[model samples]
Target: MLTIDINKQLGDLDLQVNAQIPMQGICAIFGRSGAGKTSLVNILGGLSTPDNGQLTLGATHLYHQQQKINLPPERRRIGYVFQEARLFPHYSVRGNLNYGNKDKDQVHFDTVVGLLGLTELLNRYPATLSGGEKQRVAIGRALLTRPQMLLMDEPLAALDLPRKRELIPYLLQLAKTLNLPIIYVSHSLDEILQLADSMLVLDKGKVLVNGPLHAVWDSAEMRPWLPVKEQSSLLMATITELNQKYRMSKLSLADGTYLWINGMPLPTDSKLRVRIHANHVSVCINRPTDSSIRNILSSTIAEIIHSESNDNVQVKLAFGDDHIWANITPWACDDLALKVGQAVYAQIKGVSMTESELAQSF
Candidate 1:
């Protein structure tokens, strides 16, 4: 595990954080602009010093205030990828990738090349590569350093939607294949949801919430930061069967509710996490008949949250141990008289159950 207890003052912001981040998979540092997301990662990367704190990664002590030990950036053995690619324009991709290397035995040159899909662009100059291509090369260069941990600060921020889509799969592959820990920093919820295994949310330089992605998703603290229309619940499911005739796949949820989704083919028995958006779900006093909606599960109203605008209410539904959220108008909520522990049917359309980019397979 990576332990951190640090305090720093940057201009008017007094940053303070105390949390234990897991050292396996991707741990995302998430917050809005000026939430000290970058500052915290900078401290972890040895790019900046904390006023007073202790930091330990595995058996190494990267920083200790009492002992006055602060390792230099290079000595920390942490790879960093910033918002920009930051590649050397004067050199070809191959030359830039080999610039800093003393332990060539640790990583194979061709392996890194193929992992980032840079085999075709090895001889191309930085100017000739697209934004996504340059970032891929940058990632390859970082991996070639053989760092113990990787720090990424919105690495996809500069890319357009298509470029971001193209790059996400590569990152997911890296997360699954690489044994090294990754600390990803981003303000975008979509990116965090898709890439992070655990999350550390910051608000005004303080650690608001830090824990596994699923746990944080259900926390009340996270609701305020999420857009009401974008609020959704994550469910872990397994692909049981695929209907080639309908171009849809059947997923078995933990509650034994089978949900169908239309998309690219996924391997059978592959575990996936799906997002059921609040806007796509509607509450019914009783199960409906002859409806176009494909999923209608019996659920209990566990909690109801009135929107700050007073225009809508977010109802939390419980089905077994799993929970889903539904956003309905206040009038509808009053008309139905929803209360805690009230039985209600949740209608979810098949098209509404999207294959999230954030879903992970085990």
Candidate 2:
């Protein structure tokens, strides 16, 4: 586990964080512009020092206040990929990648290059590479160091839409192929949803909430971060069956409930992350007969949250072991007489998958 209890004062913001993050998959550090996301990452990467705290990754103590033990960035063995590629202008991609490893380990070099798809650009200079290509090289350079963990600070922020899309696949593949934990820092919710298995949300230089991506996403702490219309719920599901004739796939949820989406060519049993926006869901007092909607499940109203600024209410619907959110107007809520624990039917109008393969299959 990566355990930390740190504090620092950055100008007016007092950064205080205490948490134990699992060092298994990508853990995204997310918040607004001044939420101390970068600052926290810097401290973990040994790029910046915390005023006082203890930090330990597995068996090593990166920092300890009482022991007066603090490791420098290089000694920490943490690879950092910044927003910019930061490659040496005079060097080719191969040369830049070799800078971190003077030993010139060919096996590690080839592995990193192949994983990052950097072979084609090996002899190319940084100036000649595109934004996405440059970022890949930077990532490759970092991996060549054989660091205990990888830190990416909004690596896609500097890229345009197309460039950002180009790099996301590589990021996903890298995470799956390597055993090292990745601390990805980004403000973009879309990026976090696509890349992170767990998330650590920072607010005003403090740890707000941290947990599995889906759990944190469904928490009350995350509601304010999203616009009313953009509020959504995430579900991890597995493909159980496919209807080749209709081009549809059935996904099984934790509770054994199933949802169908546009067909994906992937094999059965593939894991997928599903996103259901609140506005796309509608509640019915009774299950509609002969309805055109393909996805409708029996649910009970678990919570009724009134909107402070509008005439709408957010209803939390519990179905078996999973829950989803629905946005409805006060008039509709009253007409349906929705109450806590009241049975209802949720008609999902749309479903989106974060998996790139199903990006256009909604």
Candidate 3:
């Protein structure tokens, strides 16, 4: 785990954070423009110093104000991928990847090149590559350093939609293949939903919430950051079966309840992360019969959040150990007389599978 209890003052923003970030998978740092997302990442990377507090990665102390120990950026063993690729104009892909190394181990270089899909472009220069390809080369160069952690500050912000789409797959592959911790700073919720395993939300230099991505996404603290229509719940599901004739895939949840989506050609038993918007779910007091909806499951009401200013109410429905959210009119809620612990059926109108291929299938 990466433990941070640091305080820094950047102009008017008094940044203070105390949180333990998981060392495995991607931990996304998210907030508004001035929420100190990039500032906190800079501190962790030793690019900027904290005014006071302690920062520790495992057993090593990267910074401690009291102890007067502060490792420089290079000595911190952290790799940074900024918004720009920052490749050397005079060098080929192979040359840029080999710039920092004295040993220049062929095995390591080949492995990183293969991981980032850069072998075909090894002879090309940065100017000849697309935005996505350039970013891949930048990632390869960082991995070749063998750093303990990677810090990416809005790495896709500079790319267009197509470029971002092209680059996301490589990032997902990296998260699955490596054991290294990646602190990703991005303002795009779609990107975070697709790439992050954990989430750290900041508000005005303070930690609003931090935990597993699904949990944090479902938390009340996250609701205010998203618009009513964008509010959604995340689920980790397993592909239990494939219907080739209908081209639909069966996804099973924690409680053995399942949902179906337009199937991708992936093998059965594949894992998928899905997002269901609150507006897409409708609650029924009695299970609907002969409905057009393809996905309906038995659920119990866990919580009801009434909107004070509007006639809308958000209901939290629980199935086994997992939960899904629904936003319905107050009249509908009152008509059903929904209460905590009440059993009902949830009609899921849509499911957004976050896996690149599965998402594109829809």
Top-scoring candidate (lDDT): 1
Candidate no. 1 TM-score:
0.95
Q: State model 1's lDDT.
A: 0.87
Report how far off residue 79 is in candidate 2 (Å): 0.3
| Maximum-TM-score candidate | 1
Q: Which stretches of candidate 2 lie over 4 Å from their true place?
A: 263-265, 351-362
The reply for model 3, stretches above 4 Å from the true place, is: 350-362
* Evaluation by TM-score, superior candidate among 1 and 2: 1
lDDT of each: 0.87, 0.86, 0.86
Per-residue CA lDDT of candidate 3, range 1-362, in tens?
A: 99999999999999999999989989999888999998898999998999999999999999999999999998988988888999999999989888765578898888789988898999999999988888999998888888899999999999999989888888877777777789999888888877888899999999999999888997999985667887888877878888889778888887889988775546777777788889889999888999988899899999999887766899999998989899999999888889999999999863443243233111
How many backbone clashes does every candidate have?
1, 0, 0
Which sections of candidate 1 miss by over 4 Å? Answer: none
Write the residue-wise lDDT of candidate 2 on 197-284 in tens digits: 8999899998889999889986998885668876888877788998888777888888989888875646788877777888878999
